[model samples]
Every structure is written in structure tokens, then in C-alpha cells.
Target chain A: MDPLLYDILVALGLGLLGAVLFSAIGLISGTDETTTIAPVTLLVVLLGAPPAGVFTFWMCAAISKHMTHAVPTALLGIPGDTMALPLLQQASALRNLGAPHIALRKMLAGSVISAFIAVPLAVLFAVILAPFGTYITASAPWLFIAASVLIAYFSAGRWASVIALVPFTLLIVALQSFTGAHEVKLGVSYFLGIAIGPLVAELISAASPLERKRMNRSEPRETTLAPDVKGWGGYFPNPFRVLDRSQVRATATAAAITSGTFVFSPVAMTVIAGEIVGARIKHAYHRLTSVLAVRNGVTESTYIAEALIPLIAFGLPLSPVAAGPAAPLFNAPPRFTVNSETGVVNNLHTLMSVSEFLIWGLVSVVIATLIAYPFAMNHARSAAAFVAKRISHEAIIATFVGLILVIGLWEGGVIALLVILTVGLVGGLLYRVLGMNTGVQFMGYYAAVLSVPAILKLLG
Target chain B: MNNPTPAPASGPDGQLAEIWGDVVSRPQLGKAILIGAVVSLAVYAVALATIAPLASTPAIGKALAMLAGIIGCILGGAICARLFQPKRRVVEQIAPGAIWQTEVLDQIAIEGGAIGSVEDLPPAVAQEMREVGLYSVFQDYEQDRARNREAG
Candidate 1:
């Protein structure tokens, strides 16, 4: 047996015990407060902790982090982070029906299920594909530019909007270039982003005399009954439910095209890959669940694949989303680096070895799920009733907005707040004024990087 | 007239429904793209222009500039494009009506039940009603399943 695996198992067992303790505290406190956990966990791991031991510790932290994030989004209307934004949006609906606990469990279950599937898969994929990782990493910048431009050009309004992308991109380049070293440039960018982001929507909100109109919206179906575990289990989307013989056969016919492309942008390809999988699965019975599960798998795979590719090939760590949490745990440096001159590619074999340690993250999820699932299911009624009775709707919104403010400022600074708002406004305006999708607008921004230079060269 | 209390159910639905329009605007997108492209070029230009002053090996400067240029171009093209694209708000929706109320649906319903039973419909359908709907969730699931089975 590899010494590493043995050490990892020992650490993992200890970490599981820690996770149980944290989960219990969270259940009682109704909070997974992160202010201290992040630093404290790091202290423990960095102070002579084994790599595998760090993995176990981090895993426990991550699962609890996910579980606790549910509290604000589910109960207080606050999303823990940008990644959780969508989850919160979905969960909020359940919260409205006064069934926040159910919403929380669903999201927790989904995340836990996905984590179990993704974390190890990420490590394995990273280890196996280490050889080709470099070529893909080197090629990423162009892919990013192409995707950006294509998305921008294809947005609702075609020519005019596409043309508009040029100046927009140039302005950004000019500003970023001009303010090369100043702290304030970021502030300026943020201001521009926030101010412009919601411009159209805010305008419409103001201009639409219809704003005064009132109507009674349908109420949510409030349920206090215990959720069916089977139904809940069914809710776990099967990632591979879509590969019927016919669709698989059809896809096999196109294997050349499928294999030809290499994915660099995990976030971008996640949807594209998911759709392709869903389409192939169309011939199967139980299309919806199958479609959903497969999509989940693709999304997880994309994240795992994209994240590991950079790590293995260029020794560059790119998964800020997952790494943001994991990095602190490993006492690992924030960024992954690969220098060409050093010819450090050989060293990758050593780093790929670290993935053996991540099995702990998978283990943590299983153990955390076992501990959390019961609290979520059994105590949901009281949890829901307690939240409903104790926290006022106004309080929830205030807390949520307040959290957004703090988080926004923390991430982008006061300037970022402005930028986000600007992006939101501009995004809203493009949709309203030009009838373009935000995706296209963002695409154009990326496209302009290529097009603007091409145009400048042509005119030059 | 007493104003009807905005039911929690209707609130999230309204939020989800309205995501498309609220998310994208041309001016904002145009600016973001412009910024990304220009920055990429500038990085290259700066790297190239300063090659002469770089001490020791001049070739090193040239190589560094070229590398930076390439990376900048790629990032400007790919990441920036993605960041600035116009998308339907609902495309960003995390889950179904069971998860959150459709903000868009509430607005439509408020205008007079023009679209009813937003809840009864599949989360996918409600997602589609919003302009940003990707419609690829199920499709991706299928692809993943195939990959997994093949791997297994």
C-alpha cells in the first residue's frame, strides 16, 4: 500500500470525528459562521499537519461551509457567496412557502451529492490527464477570447450590438492600461460597472407608469408534513440516466467531432456539454430526471476536468470557486504556477499525487451528509416554524442586502459595488434597448478583444 | 384600496421571471468587451516596447512579451466575452419554482394572470419562460451519464 493512502485514511478518520462535532454545533446555533473557521482551520493544518490530514480537515470545513451557507439563503434571505447565489434564488421560493428547511435540505443534498461525485473525479481526472494538460493550458487565452466574441455577436440584436462591443472593450483596455499601478483604477472600474449595470432596468423601473399597478400574486403551497425520503432520494439527479442505446449510438457516430475539441473553460463548456448529453438522452424514457442528472454530472465533470487540467499541465491552479475553500485547507498557495523555462513539467507527477489526499473531501461529504441529512429532515418542521416566527420578512431582506453589501465590498471593494451595479444596469439596458441577451453582451466584450485589435490593424 | 400582500410564493416567481430583462443591457456589455480587448493589446505593446531596456538577454524580453500578448489575447477573447455577454436572467436561475418564486411570472401574472399556474409547470418550463433560459440542463445530464458509463 502506498504510504500516502495509509496516512490519508488515518487523517480522514480523525477529520470525520471533527465534522460530527461541527455539524452538531451548527444544528444548534443555526449558523455556520465563517469569520473564524477559515483562519482557525488553516492554523491547525499549517502547524505540522500532514497533507492528507489537511485534506480531511478541509473537507469537514467545506461541507459545513456549504451546509451553513444554507441558513442565510434559506432563512435570512442572504446568499453566502456568488456561487451560492443561484442556489439561494431557488431556495428562496421554498422559503416563501415557509418551508425553508425543505429548500435547505434539497440544496444541501444536491451539493453533497455533487461534491462526492466531483471531488474525487477531479483528482483522478487531473492525475490521468497530466500529459496533455500543458497544451490545453497554453491554448486557454484564445478560447476565452473566441467564446467572448461569439457570445457577444450572437446576442439578440446582431450587427449594431456587436459593433458596440468594440468601443466598450477598448475603453476597458485603455482604462486598465492607463491606471496600470493605481489602486483607484479598480475603484473606477467598479464604479463604471455598477452604475451602468442596472441602468436600463432602473430606467424602466422609473419610466414604466405601470409600476403603480398592483396585483395579488398566488400564494405558495405551505407544507409542514415530513418529506418522503424516497421522493427526496429521487430528487438526486442521476448524472448518467440519459445514455440510451440509440442516443449513445448516434453520439458514437460523431465521435470524431466530440473527441476533436478539448475543453479549457470549465464554466463555459459546462452548459454546452450538458446540453449535448441531454440531447442524446432525449430518446430515453424519464427524460426530465435523466436530463437533469446527466447535466449535473457534466457540470461536475466540467468543474473537475477544467480545474485539474490547469493544475496538471501548467501547474496553474484556476478553480477559484472550489479552490477558494480548498486552498486554505491544504495550506496550499492560492495560485497554481508552471514556468516554461524551468522545464518543471516533470514535477507535475508529484503534485498530481496530492489528489490522493482529496479522497478525504469525498469522505467528509458522506459523513457530513449522514450527520446533516437527519437534522434537516427530522427537525425541519420546528426549524421552519422557528425561522418564520423569529425572523421578520423585513429583517430577512435587510440582512440579505446587508450581506450582499459586505460581500460585494469585500470582493470588489466599494468600487466593485459600483462596477457590479454598472454591469447590471448595462446588462439590463442591452436587454431592453437592443433586445440582446446578457450572454451575448458578455460575449461581445470578449470578442472585442480580438475584433478591436483586428480592426485596428486593418485600419492602421 | 388595500394593497394585496405580495405573497412569498409570488415574490420569488416574479424575481425569477424578471431575471432576463434585468440582466443584460447593451451599453454595459459593450464597455466590458472594449475594456477586455484593449487591455490584452496594451499588455503586448508594453511587453514589446520595453524589450530593449530589459537587462541581460534581450531575447528573453521578446519571448516574455510574446507570451503575455498571447495570453492577453486569449483571455481578452474568451473570459471577457463570457463576462460581457447578454443572457436571459432565468438562465441564471438555480432551480425550479419549487425552489424559488419566479419573479418574472409574478410580474406577468400581475399584469393580469396572462401566464397562470407558473408553479404547476416543470421548473425547466418556468425557466424557459424567462428569456435567459439555457434549455440545456437535461441535455448536459445525458452527456454526463454517457461519459460516466463509458468511464465505468
Candidate 2:
């Protein structure tokens, strides 16, 4: 068999495997599989990439996982990745409004558009921008500061969030001081991830108190394409469809740009991109338009950036999001680092490896979208009715909180409890007293630390 | 489970936001600025003392210390605010009644091709909920109306 053919068959099979695994676990646990796949896939690559033959296997496995992750998110409220959170919101809101099928259709359409648009664009952009990357990264501190401030100002609200700016700016400087200490000691951002992580886990755990009672809920069935909303026009850049076109443009632009800048910094970029895109959309368009664009833009951008970063910058396996399903293919190692500092030609160097990964990943999205959209319309009504009858929303959220707590504990040991307790106390207070978003406050804290020192430096 | 409820006067959300504001509030704007200036000086003192001895690479060490100084300043500010006013939840008033009217309900019924049984709702509410995609909330109203009719 031709190598390309071989890779496709293997990739397709793996995608099926990923879909089955995600579906089984998602249905059983009542959590969305899409939410878990990308991180897991990246983790697989991170662990398994150093071995010669494993890189191809990891790439195939990851693409397969991305292909199927959308199912639970579109069908249920479970987002496959953090990027899918906004779509989940719109989908759930629409589900409540009795048009879940339409929402799913729209999401599938947008995902497909972005998948096709983003992958090739990211690849080309990486190729075009690769030469300048080292220089760009060197100058990233200022960019990071600027991005943080912009995100803070907008997300916190111009006036209201400004109150958070001082403290938040200081907090970033504080966190960075700590991060710099770890960097000198540990040599990279990896361990710093360890420290900053608890903060997030604590915040989520604190804010998310488990609900004791399960509430009544309905589920929407897979939908068929409505006659009016069919064909390429339905899925493509149809500028006439004002709201939908804007969603495509914003998500595509954000996703593409974010992937290109992945190596500079992931968290800062994710938050900043989300804030900027969201705020821009909010300002440029109506509330509904902004909601659609920002939601789709952030979710898709995060996913694209994760996949692109390791592949382009270091020839490493994609992030954990893409790595999990890809694990079994590379001989299921207990641990492996998915990076290629040096390698023989045609034998999967980082450059070729990532390009191949992007090419195939794009192809899978197109195929998945075609299959999902038509299939969805037929099942929409039944799926909706079944979902309504079977699942409870409150129960789902409670389970999610439980999962977060478990994950937090797994990550931070006994500290998870303290973190959660602290976050809940602080988060609750912020919620009750701040007259602003807790997420903004959280971001502001991180940004504040970054800003204070930068300002002092400027003054001096 | 005995979930602690808020006092009747102020709700949970309001109380929490207030405490956060107080904690982050700049006290006697002039005094706070003066305090910030002093804190900046202390940071400089600490930086000069620590960097000269502790650093293997003087540049990286100084950079790291400066980062530490900024962190200190923020912690100092937040701490100062908290000290100024001990953490306390403040309460505000809540308004009552359906923030809606019955006329909009009849119009919505006409538009959706449903029976014009708008008696259960005020039009203002029906209109607002519909706009926000919360129309299903009216189900409770319909249920209540049904119960009243049965009782009558």
C-alpha cells in the first residue's frame, strides 16, 4: 500500500477507536468526550514522541481523536476541549429554545470551516513565520504584558475592571517572580505549570459547588439538514449570512493566528486571544453576534494553537489533548517525550512530521463535518427527545464538579483541598462584593503581577 | 445539608462583591499612594541586598529579584486594603414581584400560533423572556393557572 494510503487507513481506524472510547466513557460518566480528547492526545505525544517510529503513530491517533471529540459537545453539553465551551453554551441555549439540531448543524459547519481554514493556514503561516520565531519569542515579554492589560481592561469592563488592574498587575509580577525562580531551577515552563495550575484548579473547585439534587432535563436528537440550510453554501464562507459569516471569520482568524504564536506562551495567548476576540466581537457586533463569534473564536483558537505549537516549534507530539488516543499506537509506553531534536530524513523529522499532521488533520475535519451534518439532521428530533427524557443537567454539572475536585487532588495532593477552600472563599467574596467577573478578577491577578514591575522599569 | 443562607437584607452575590471591593479599595487615595511609594523603596533595598550575594548569574538574579519586588508590592496592596476594612459582607435591597406585565403574553401567543390564553402572564414578562430565550419559564405560570381553574 502507498504510505499515504497506509497512513489514512491507520488514522481513520484510530479515529474510530478514539470515537468509541470517548463515547463509551462519556455516555457512562455523563461527561462530554470532546472535553477530554485534545489534552489526552497531546499527553500521548509528550510521553511517546522521542522514539523513531512512534511520531507517525501519535499524529494519526491525535487526528482521529479530534475528528470524534465534537460528537459529545454537539450532541450533549460536554465540550471536547476548552475551545468547545462557547459552542456548548450556544448549543445548550439553543437546545433550551427548541433548535438544538440547528445549533449543532451550525457548530459542525463552523468547525469544518475552521478545520479546513485553520490547518492549512497554520501550516503556511508557520512555514512563513518560522524564520522570525526566535526573535519574536525573545520580545514576547512586552507583548505578553500588553496583551494581559488589554484582556484585563476589556474583560473586566473598561471602568469596573480597571479597579482590578492594580492588584492584578502586581499579582502577575509576583507569579512571574515565582515562575522565574522555578525557571532558573527547573529550566522551563513545565514546573511553573505545576504551580500556576493549582490556582486554576482551586478557582474552578471553589466556584463549582456540587449540587445535591438532580434537575429535570431534555436531550436533543441528532438533526437532519433542513432544506433551506443545505449544501456547500451552508458550510462555507457565505458572507450573506451575517451572523454565521462573522463567526467563521472571527474563529478562523483567531484560531489561525493563535496556532502560529503557540510557542511564545500558551496560557497568556489563550486568555488574551479569548478576551480580545470576544471584546472585539462584542464591540463590532450585537450581543448575539458577539456571543457567537467570541465563543467560537476562543474555543477553536485554543484547540488549533495547542495542536500547532508542539508540531511546528519543537517537532513534538501535539499537546495532551491530541496525545491520549495516539498512545496505544506507539506501543503504549509508560512515559516518552515526543520531541525530535535530530533524526534521519524521510524517517519523520519534526518539520515534515508536523506538516503531515496538519494536512491529515485538515482532511479529517472535512470528512467528519460532511458525515456529522447530514446524519445529525435525521437524528435531531429523536436525540433531542431522548436527551430530554434521559439526562439531567444539574446532575451533569455536579458530576463535572466532582471530576474537577478529583483532578485537582490528583494534581496537587492535599494542597488541592486548601486551594479549593481558599478559592471558594476568595471567589465567593469576589462574586459577592466585586461587582465584576470572577474570571476577570482571576485574570487580573495574574496580569497585575506582570504589570507592576514593567511599570517600575519604565519609570526608572 | 445546612447551607448557610444570606441575611434577609442582602443577597449572596451582592454581599460577596462588596467585600471584594472593600478589600481592593485604595484607602485615602493619597495615603495609599504614599504607602505604595514607600513599599517601592523597600523593594529596592531588598533587591540591592539580595542580588549582590545570592546571584550566580548577576543579570538573571537581578531580573528575578525585580520580579519579586513587583510581587511584593501587589501583595502589600491587597493586604493593606484587607487590613483597612476587615472582610465583611454588605447587603442591599431586593425588589419584588414579576418584573413583567400581561400584555406581551397575548402578542407572543398570537405570533407563535398558540391559543391566546394570555391570562396567566403579564405581556412585559412574556416579551422580555422571549427575547432572552427564557420563554419556557412561563410553563410554571400555565401550571399554576391550571391548578387555580381546577380549584375554582
Candidate 3:
């Protein structure tokens, strides 16, 4: 057997495995990307998979998850993850217009198209940015703070998000110190805290008498599953056939633009790209549907771009998505480490070249498209129906809660659990009340770790 | 004429302004934002004084100071949210009759040059499809797919 051929086969298999696993997981609503993805990728790395296997598996999972995450958001009006938030408005709007099936097809088709574009564009952008990695890295701390503030300001909460960042960053630093004192440095639990904050807040509210009274609905929430429209003329029915000319153009253009700029938040990119598309569209019906397509496409494009560009260009986690959800790829410690202060990088940068990233990224996209696109196209109605009817929201929340508990205990036993509660309670309440979402909270987490110290030193 | 609700203002592009364009003019939002800023700054001051002493390193000190600031901001946010009195307004911008997903797909097939007609349909239904951009000769699957690929 040829060794090179053997490696390619194994990587393809690994990528397929990841795509299959996450495409199904993507159907379960309220699953946070960072909380679920970071841990799973970390586990794959720890299990001592080959470099290709690790990269393909991670990339495949990320691509596949974003594609199918539109399921719940478009069908049930519940977000599949944080990135799926912006699509909820358009999805619900489509649903109210009695066309969730159409929304699902458009979203899935957009993901397939965007994922195809994002891989090559992200590689090209990374190559262009590679030469400036050192200069960019040296100024990471101040950059993160400035970026955090800017992102917070643009968040739906707007100025309120900016103000909330003060307390959020402070809270993260306080918790890190409290845990660090116990010699158990924490990271993933903090993410899970912010990720599941809303759930915990709702549960807490359910316990209060007055709040429980307010929480009670007169009837169970209703979900309407629209009839699945068969393809114009085909047995397999290619997903792309469902979208219009302008939709395809808008989505591709948006995906290309988003794939290159690896600096901003994914939510911000989604909004900006969607706005760019929406502003130019003239028809009312077309504008609504086209914006939905572009926004969902932006989700896939931005995630791939954020991960690949930073991974390939700097070999360091510079972008928020890289620093947050995709951190395991760059710095899972003893196994992979890229120290900001010492200029020590022993991660993908050293392990893989730009060509390898390009090849493997394309492989991941192909695998994800094979698994997610056809399934989403063919079974959009049944899948949406299954998720809305069978998957209990409590069970999903409980599953994540259990995962967070084990992770917390794994970090520092009882103290880590306390940290999770403190962060989740405060973070959740702040989010619920102020509308400051998980994206800004993630930025706040980064600020606490990187920026707060820099600010302190400058003052000193 | 009793309750004449003017249609939403249109942009230069002819698309209606966002559904929430009216809510943006609410005077209460400005007041809430001002309160929020004042509260955040005061919290920053108190946090700096209180958290500066508990740190072991410059990084730790700065982080602690941030923690203090976060605590202040949360308190302030809660107060402001209460003061603002959030309410819900169900704005129905798109009517069900306006959404024609099937017609859109028909238009796509025709624009991609897959077919010239919505075959076996009434003249009215065919006209609706044509109005949405579905009037072209049927082309091969490969040609249509290729055309859409380039557009996409």
C-alpha cells in the first residue's frame, strides 16, 4: 500500500466520521458550538490521532455542524447554536409565512455553496496574511480589547453590550483567579457557563413562585411542519436547484467576502454580509428569502474562515472563533502549544503546511457536503418534524448540563463547579435582562485572559 | 379611514425599512443608554479601587479590576432594564399571500433556463410563475447546473 494514499484514505474516513456525527448533533437545538465542539476536538487530539486525522475530523465537524444547525433554527424557531441566532429572525419570518420547508432548503443549499467557496478563499487569505503573523501576534492583547469593545458596541444589545463587557470581563478574571489559586486553571467550563447560562437562568426562574407563574403558558408551544416540496425533476434532487439566481449570487459573494476577513466576530460578519445583500435587493419576498440565504451562508463561511485563516496564517489562535471554539487545534497544551509571550508555537503551524491545510480543508468540506447537504435537502420536513416533536428541550439541556458538570469536576473538582454556577448565574441573568449575547460574552472571556493584564501593566 | 396606519417608509432600493424602524425613535432608549454608561463608568472606578489590592501580578490585578467592573455593570444593567420597561410588539411585516416559495423555485428553474413553462398549469398560475421570472426554454441538467454554479 502506498503510504501517501493510505494517509489520504484515513483522513477522508476520519472527516466522514466527524461529518456524520455532528450533522446529527446539529439537529438538537440549543447545543452551543464552543462548549460541544472544543471538548470533542480536544478529545480527538488527546486520543493521539494522526495530524491529518485530527485536522480533517475537526474541520469536518465544524463545517457539518454549521450546515445542519439551520434545522432547528429554521424549523422550530429555536437556535441550534450561537451562530444560528441571526438566522432565527428570517427563519421565523419564513415560518410565519408558511414556508419553513423552503427556508430549510435555502439555508442548507446556501451552506453547501458557501462551504465550497470558503475553503479555497480562506486558504488564499491565510497565505496573504502569513507574512504579517509576527506583527499581528505581538499586538494581540491590545487588539483583543479593542476588538472586544467594537464587537460589543455592534452587538444587538449595542451600548448595553459595551457596558456589560466591563462586568463580564471582570467576572471572568475573578473566576480564573479563584480557580487558579487552587492550581486548576480553567477554560472550557467558563465557555459552558456562558453557553448554558440562559438555560440555568430559566431553570432558576422556574423555581420562583412569581416567576413560575409568569413562565406558565396557557398552552404548549405550537410548531407547524410545512409540506415538503419535491424537486422540479429529479430522483436525488440536487439541493442547489431550489435556490434562485440572485440568491445564489448573493450567497456566493457574501461567502467569498466573509471567507477572507478572519479578524471580526462570526455574528458581526453574518450581520454585515446579510445587510450588504439585503440593502441591494429590491423585491420584498426576494429580499426576505435572499437575506436568509446570505446570512446562513455567512455562518458557514465565517466559521471556516475564522478557523483556517488563523490556523494557517499565524499558527496561533488570533481570531475569536479560533481563540474560543477552535482553541484545541492550536493549543491543547503539552500536545499542542503556542505561547503568546515566548513566541513558542508547536501547533498546526509547525505540523502542517499551507498546501496541506488547503487540501484537508477541501476534503473536510466535501465530506460535510456529502453527509449534510443531501440529507437536509431530502428530509428537511421529516428531520424538522422529528426534532420538534421527539427531542425534549429538557433532555438536551440536561445532557449539556451533565457534560459541563463532568468538565468542571475534571478541571478542579468542587471549586470548578462553583465557578460554573457563579458564571452561569450572573452571565445568564445579564444576558436574559440586557440582551448581551454569547458572542460578546466570549469576547469578554478573551479580554479577561489577554487584555485585562495588559491594561493593568500599562497602568502600573 | 378610521385607523389609517401608513405603510412603512421605503428605502431608495424600494424595499421597506426594517420592521423596528419605529421603535428606534422611542425617547426611552436614549435615557436607558445614558443611565447604562454612567453606571458602567462608576462601576469601573469602584472596581479599580477595590480589586487593585487582591492581585499577585499586573495581569492578575488588571483582571481583578475587570471583575470589579463587571460586578458594577451587571448591577447597573439590572437597574436600567427595570427603568426601561421592556414590552413586546408583534409587527407583521410579510403577509402569507406575499410569500410564494414554489413560484420562486419555478422562477429559479426558468432563469437557470431549465424550462419554458410551469407545465399543465392554468394561465393565471403560469402568469404568476412568469411574473416571478419563470419564462425560458428548457435546457439540459448539466447546462442548468453549470449556469447556477457560476452564478452561485
Candidate 4:
């Protein structure tokens, strides 16, 4: 068989797998992208998938999840994931106005259109920036430090998150040395710990007597699942028909503009894009629907740009999205790695060429759109209801717990498990108290690995 | 054999708490977590003992074992799902009435949005609203606002 044909086949297979898997996962709320995508993509890399396969898998998974995530956000008034939170107000308003289906369709159409627009634009932006890749990699240590501070400042905690990075970096350094003494070097454990920090904090808080009153619930929570209306005839609804002319134009423009601003937080970008678009529309109904469309569109575009730009341009996890959910593509060790001292990279960036990235990137998006978009459109109400009624939160928690244990032990051993616990507890508490979210914590991890070494050498 | 009124129930495994983002019975959550850890670890241990020696590369063997362990995690979750139900009251919402639609529009206006007149909408948008049966709703709301302004 031709090697090129084999690579495409592998990429398509993995892309389909990722799309199908994550589309289901997206229906369950509170599954953060970093916590879910990073570890799974890491598994793919470590399992010795081809570089194209790995890249396509991540791209398809991210796109598919974003598309289907609108289901719960529109129908149940619950955010499908962190990215869906900004769209909830519009979704809920539409739900109250008895047109949640409109909100859902608009979001789906926006995401599909934006994803198509974002891919080519992101690749173009990345190519334009690719000439500076060598310089970026050489000064990666200093860049990591500066990027950490900038990302932290932009986090919800603002100055508090910026101040919190010091302790967080120190904590990681201390743990590294402690494990180094035991002849155990762990990387995935730390990622797992930071990714699952919020859950760890919540579990601990639930166990504490002091937090019992806050954590306790006397009755089950109530959620009003709105009735869905099918406005389209067939399974594959045309996005152009779903959105009005103004909405399509707004979504495309927002997606194109946001594809260049990849360094900022995706949530912030989504909010700002929606605000700008919403403020321009005069009618209240149009404002609500248009904002939903644009915000969801921005979510897709921002993720694509943030992940693709750094991967193509610099081969570094520079953006918040790159550092968090897409970290494995840049720095999954052994199979893929970014050397802390030398700033050397051996990941998809080195393995695949620029043309391959573009080709495979678009291929993954098309695969995701085919599998997730229509499924979400046709079976959203049933899927949402099935997940809500059948899948217990306890089951989800149990799965995560199993993941933590398995990944920790697989990485090193008991020592690695202990490292995960320590990092998770501390990082989780800091995130809870200071609003230094997972993205900032991920940047802090990079700082500990990259910047701390540079600072020590300078002092010496 | 039964009394007319049962004695007040004690706190025997009736502790409900919100963990992560959803509510769960505390005792059941504890059991679920235990099952998750035990099942996954047990699978990993067994795979290491059985599969590690047979594989050509130790790393590949370990990776395969981790995959099995992840599957074990999902299996454990499935078991828990079968055992425990979700702690949520899911109410299927009915179609909202005109009054509720007006209230929602009012709330949107209060949030600094412009409730523009239906007559000013573009053709495509007006067609969309008509298809969704919201064109008359918006037009009526605009008339009501106009009447109130004149009366005032």
C-alpha cells in the first residue's frame, strides 16, 4: 500500500473515533476540555499512533465536541462544557420564549460555518508566522515566563492569579526535585493532577465537616428540559438556511478575526465576540439568536486557531488552549517531547510538514462535521434525555477516579500517585480560592518546567 | 404489624451532597469511587502480570495494559450507573404561553437589549420569525407598547 494512502486512512480512522467518542462525552456537562482531551490525546501519542493520526484525532475531537455541546446548553439550560457557558443566557432566554430549537439550530449552524472558515484562516496565519519559529523556540524559556504572567493576568483572578503563579511554580519545582531524588520522573501525572484539580478540590471540600453546609443538598436539583421543535426536513440541515444572511456574515467575520487572536483565553474571546455582534443587532430576538450563533462560532474558531497556530508556527504550546487541551500534540514525552533545557521539540510539529497540517486539519474538520453535526441535529433531544436520565453523576465521578488512579500508576508508581494527589489538592485549592483556572495552572506548569531552569542557570 | 406513624427517620445513609457540579448521595459516591479505583487498579495489576512478559516491548505492553485499565474504569462506571440513579428532577417543559413570552422579552429589554419593531426587520429574518410563529407575537408586543405610550 502507498504510504500516503495509509497515512490518510489512519488519520481518517482516528479522526472518526475521536469524533464519535467526544460527541458522547460532550453531552455530559462539566467535562472540561483539558481534563478530557489532553489525557486521551496523550494516550494516542504514547500508543504510537502516526503523527497525522494524532493531529487529526485531536482536531476532530475538539470540533465534534463543540458542535454537540450545544445540545445540553440549548435544551436543558445546563452548559455542555466550559465553552458553552457564555451561550447559556441566550439559550435560556430562547428556551423561555419557547424556541430552544431555534437557539440550538443557530448554535449548530454557527459552529459549522465558523469551523470551516477558521481552518483555512488559522493555517494561513500560522504560515505567515512560521518564519519566526526558530527565534520563538530559542527564546522559549523567557517566552514561557512572559506568557504565564500574561495568561494569569487575563484569568478570572487577574492580579491574584498572577501572584499565585509563583507559589504554583515553586510547588511543581519542589515536587520535581522530591521525585527526582526517588529516581522517578513524572510528567503525565502532573498534567493529570492539574487537569482534574477542580474535581479533587470538590471531593475534599465535600468530605470536610466545615464545608458540609455548603456542599449538602437536601433534595435533587431540578432541571426543566425544554421541548425541541424540528424546523428542518431532513437529517442534514443546511447551515446557510438555518442562519439568516446577517448572522452568517457576522459569524464568518467573527471567526476570521478571532483566528488571529489565538493567544487570549477562548472564553473571553467568545464573550467579547458575542457582545460586539449582539450590540449591533437592534431586535431583542435577533440579538439573542445572533449572539448565540456568534458566541458558539467564536468558541470553535478560537480553539482551532489557538491549537493550530502554535503547533504550526512555533512548535510550542504557547497559547492557553495549546498549553491546556492541546498540550500533548506539543509535548507528550518519549513519543513527543519538548526538552526543558535545550528548548528542543520532537512532536507533530517536527514530524509533519505545513502542507500535511493543512490537509489533515481540513480533513478532520470535515469528518467531525459529517459525524457529529447531523447526529446532533437529528438526535439531540433523545441524546440529551438519555444522558440525563441514565448516566449518573456518581458514574462519571467513578470513571474520573479510575482515570486518575490508572494514569498515575502507569506514569511512575506509588510516588507518581502521591505527586498527583499533592499537586491536585494544592492546585485545586488555589484555583478555587484565587480563580486561577486550569489554563493558568497549565501555564504555571510550563513555567516550572521551562522558565525555572533558565532562571536558575542565570543565577548560577 | 405496622404502626400508624413511623418513627422519625435517622441519618442512615441519607446524606446527599453536591460534588463536582451535580448532586449525589454521599454513601453511594464513596462506594462508586472505591469501585472505580479498585476495578481499574485490579485490571492494571492483572494485565501487568499476564501481558507484560508476552509482549515484544515492555513499553507497548504497558500501554496496552493502561488501555485495558481505562476500559475497566468505564466498566466500573457502567456498573455504578446500573446501581445508582442520577439525583436530578428533570421536568419536561411545556410550550410557553404569550404572557411568558412577553415577560421574557421584558427581561431581555431590562438587560439593555433593543426590542425593535417587527416592521423594521429584514425580509429573511421576518420570514424566519413567521416560520417559527413569532412574527405576530413580536408585532402584538410592539402594538401594546405603542398603546401604552399613547395612553400615558
Q: What is each predicted model's overall lDDT from 0 to 1?
A: 0.41, 0.39, 0.68, 0.92
Where model 2 places Cα greater than 4 Å from the true spot, the runs are A1-103, A156-354, A363-378, A381-387, A393-398, A420-460, B1-152
Task: Compose the digit string of candidate 4's lDDT tens values, residues B1-152.
Answer: 87886343224437788888888889899999999899988998898889877889999999989988999899899989998899888999977899999998889889888899888889989899998888888899999999999999
Best by TM-score: 4
Compared with the true structure, what per-residue lDDT tens digits does model 2 show for residues A1-460? 8976665676565454443444233322222222234233433333323232234333333332333334445444455443354455444444433333345444444444555566676667556656755554344335435544444454424555556556544544444455455452111122212222332332333334341111111211222211112223333333223234455566666666765654332334545655565454321112223344444433444445445543454332223322222222221212332211111112133325555656655655544444443444344334333333343322222222333333333333344444444444443444334533333443343333323445566699
Candidate 2, position A3, lDDT: 72
Query: Which scores higher on DockQ, 3 or 4?
Result: 4
lDDT for A418 (candidate 3): 88
TM-score of each: 0.42, 0.43, 0.71, 0.97
**Docking category for candidate 3?**
incorrect
Screening candidate 3 with a backbone cut-off below 3 angstroms (N, C-alpha, C), the clashing residue pairs are A167-B70, A170-B66, A170-B67
Q: Give the clashing pairs for model 4.
A: none
Any runs in candidate 4 off by more than 4 Å, and if so which? Answer: B1-13
| Chain B TM, per prediction | 0.31, 0.43, 0.43, 0.88
Cα displacement (angstroms), candidate 2, residue A237, comes to 18
- Residue-level lDDT of model 1, residues A313-427, one tens digit each, is 3443333222222223312211122232222332222343554545555666666666554554455445544433342222222222232233233334555555555555665
Could you give candidate 4's per-residue lDDT for residues A1-460 as a string of tens digits?
Answer: 9998998788899999999999999888778898899989999998999999999999999999999999999998999999999999999999988899999999999999999999999999999999999999999999999999999999999999999999999999999999999999888999999999999999998989999888887777788888777877878999999999999999999999999999999999999999999988888888889999999999999999999999999999999999999999998877788989999998988999889988898998899999999998889999999988999999999999999999899999999999999899888888889999988999999999999999999999
lDDT of 3 by residue, A1-460 (tens): 9978887787888899899888988886666787668767775665456778889998889888888898878766777888888888767755655566667777888888898899999999998988998887777777667877776776668899999999889988988887788887766567667766766676566556666444533223444445555544553456455567667888999999999877777988898887778777544345556778888889999999999998988776767688667877876654786453434578877888889999899989888888887777677667867655554333343334445444455445678788888887887878778877666787788778767777888899
Docking class of 4: medium
Which has the higher lDDT value, candidate number 2 or candidate number 4?
Answer: 4
Instruction: Evaluate residue A83 in candidate 3 and report its C-alpha lDDT on the 0 to 100 scale.
Output: 84
